[model samples]
Target chain A: MLNELRKIQKKHGYVSEDSIKKLSKKTGIPVSIIYGVTTFYAKLHTKPTGKYIIEICDSPSCYLNGSLDIIKYLERKLDIKSGQTTQDKKFSLFIDSCIGCCDEAPAMLINGKPYTKLTKEKIDKILKKCKS
Target chain B: MQILRKTDQKAYAKAKKLGPKGVVKILKDKGLTGRGGASFPTGLKWEMVLKEKEKEKYIICNADEGEPGTFKDKFILVNNPELVIEGILIAAYTIKATRAYIYLRGEYEYLENKIRNVIKKVKAKTKSKANIELIVGQGAYICGDETAIIASIEGKRGQPRKKPPFPTVHGLYGKPTIINNLETFANVPLAILFDDWDSKLTLFSLSGDVTKPGVYELPVGTNLRKLVELGKPKHKVKAVYFGCFGGCMPYSNINLTNENVCGKDCMLGAHTIIVVDEKHSIVDMATNVAKFYEFESCGKCTPCREGTMRILNILENISLLEARKRDLETLQELAEVVKETSLCGLGQTATQHLLNALKFFRKEFEEKCR
Candidate 1:
């Protein structure tokens, strides 16, 4: 039922307890089990997030190619830490393990679209597009 | 070195002329194997799935290349998606599968539309009965494992199930399923179409401390020294890590061949070759890899869930200079236990990086401890 939760979250921003209860009633799966699954996956969020989710890959390959610099740049540009959403709910930044784009190191997903071989200038452009 | 450059149009025509059984015979003759870590014979897998009496057999193409240092699948998907589709269609026709799903990684969300369009085009052109759907993963590395992938497709937490009922027998909502990796499926068209198909040519993802790090199509037995030459090391190479967190070998020990790389104890998983130069610290590398496992463990069972965390803790302590000499012995013992006791391949091979590090880079661990 993780996919169901994902759909609900996609529609409603987060899988609220009320939606979980409704899903439980609909699928006959217990609310507790549904909640456990939501907490298990990193992609599923209990709280509301920003309009755009920026997930930066911090795995070894990305790290070797300076993924940390991208993370720092995002943190500074957004004025928030990795797990936090901006006050305006414009963006939510996170450090993901690996996004399977190691061929293009220093890669990340800007609202699920990949931006690879990141640079300070490229980050500025991406952030500008998000802000606009 | 240029390996697989152009699609063999002649072979494609030949395979199409030969029908399903004839193509199967050619695959059996070629002895093509799965490109996804396991390296099981592709022909044998197709034959087994074909023999299943179940009517609702499904074909799953694993595009969830989550293993770190592995991007060969992504390359194949981007460059020649049609080839992969042909492979999937060939598999479905051979197995009489009416439904198929490409379990793509969420990071590869951009490729979804393109692949869907290709599937639509192929469906229109071939008029195949199999309905293809793309299932995007939710950023879980464990889902790359076949059983866990099936669980994910079932809308459940991506945890592995017991193996008595393998996917070939019982899979994907309790029906027979044949799940092949993107690379494995991509090779199907080549195997079917070309009379001169060489199964030895495989995609390798090369990265880390190399000047020309990228995906390359090379022979199975290509030597590490030659591959290193292709990449052109930025510094003197100290060691090479094969597969993604699977195994580590000193530069001197690498043969770069599939057989030598994947022997009894070791697995040349995903053909991910990570070169570590002399300036880098093996302890730090091992610690990072252990931390990755600790984070990604599905927590279905105790051995993997708890053991990975303990291994990470021990490695971190050693890196921080808080570990005693006996801590090394404890770490080795723990790795052996985890390797033997874990349920799935992820847990079973999790400690391989650490164990191999301990074996080849003992002095690095000793220096950190001191």
Candidate 2:
């Protein structure tokens, strides 16, 4: 495990990839599987996340609910594309398929939290908060 | 408890002073997310609502915790009404909403009165621009969907529709409406105030394997294995299931902490962990969840309505078959069919457990066949 942790420290600059792999390996999971743990799920991260991880649910539920517009609005405001970190290192905008709150479709996840039934105004408000 | 009965005034005060952006910061720092099934970042959700188009929109709090074996919302209503109120204020302000509604579950009869008292208390004090209303649901789980929920609010049938223009565009009497889950709304204030939802050990309605089954608060990222080992007393845990019957998962797949199996639904889904101890059969868990889907599936979609029933019957009959690779292929095929054609997300994701169980625990399913 220690060896794997050191390997992760050497592999990635943020959120140890090796530790996750070691954990997965210990749990009978593959390294790629561990990546799925982070990649597939928005909450789990493979890298040391930026200050803010702006997540808009792009799942069928959220997308069909208007997350695409929300994403566009965010991209325009942040001047960064989805799955990319902001220049200021303050915000990391990305798309999450689902955070499980479909009842509040058109949802988002900033960091690990979820916001449902989104709008441009609400997105701006959240970005403004992240700016603070 | 009396405090729970009153409107969540403290949340408003915090939002008032915190401002929209500041609230987001606090929420981000506190790691707070909406507790209503989908564990999206509450601060971010508020941010989205705040940064959006300038239209008279609506905010609805979803208190219809009807997924079976889930009741953490009751505690939020009992212990943190003010928090919920504060979340609403922030959400309303962010979304530029003129009004906010708390669509509480009808089964929670006490929630209605308690919420009403809180609204009255807030009304007595300084009122915000947004009007707050406390409404009751007919205890229909389908009503939990945003579209169905909107229809219900408009005095229509509670059935979800095909999304496209989405709710942010057309919702609630043709106006943009944002509906959040009960726990999601409760997390709003905190997310607006704190960045991490794991500031404390949130409550979980754990039952099955161990001893204690009532609602208990466990530290975020706490290993479920440890909880199983020490939650109540070490019992024979055959398999652990996360989420409820609606979202229940099989054991082996149950690992806790950041490991995925550890926490049931810390942020995104139902927090009910049903432990099918060694004594019970995984087939039984599958049966219960399958039965749940069969019953709860909104008939709007044929694949879900029929596929779910078919999956249940197949699994039940698999025990009678020779338990060959063909049965496995059949199970996988049924799962795929259900996954492809479900109208709502619940029906679609319902097969995650069954698929995983059949794939990993093939021996167990085969054992049942004998």
Name the best candidate (by lDDT).
1
The total number of steric clashes, by the backbone 3 Å criterion, in model 2 comes to: 61
Off by over 4 Å in 2: A1-132, B1-8, B162-166, B191-201, B244-268, B318-328
Docking quality (DockQ) for each candidate: 0.62, 0.01
Task: Give the runs in model 1 whose Cα sits over 4 Å from its true position.
Answer: A1-4, A25-29, A76-79, B1-19, B262-265
DockQ top scorer = 1
Q: Which digits, one per residue and each the tens of the lDDT, describe model 2 over residues B260-282?
A: 64243222256565555556556
DockQ of 1: 0.62
| TM-score for candidate 2, residues paired by index | 0.64
CA shift at A104, candidate 2, in angstroms? 29
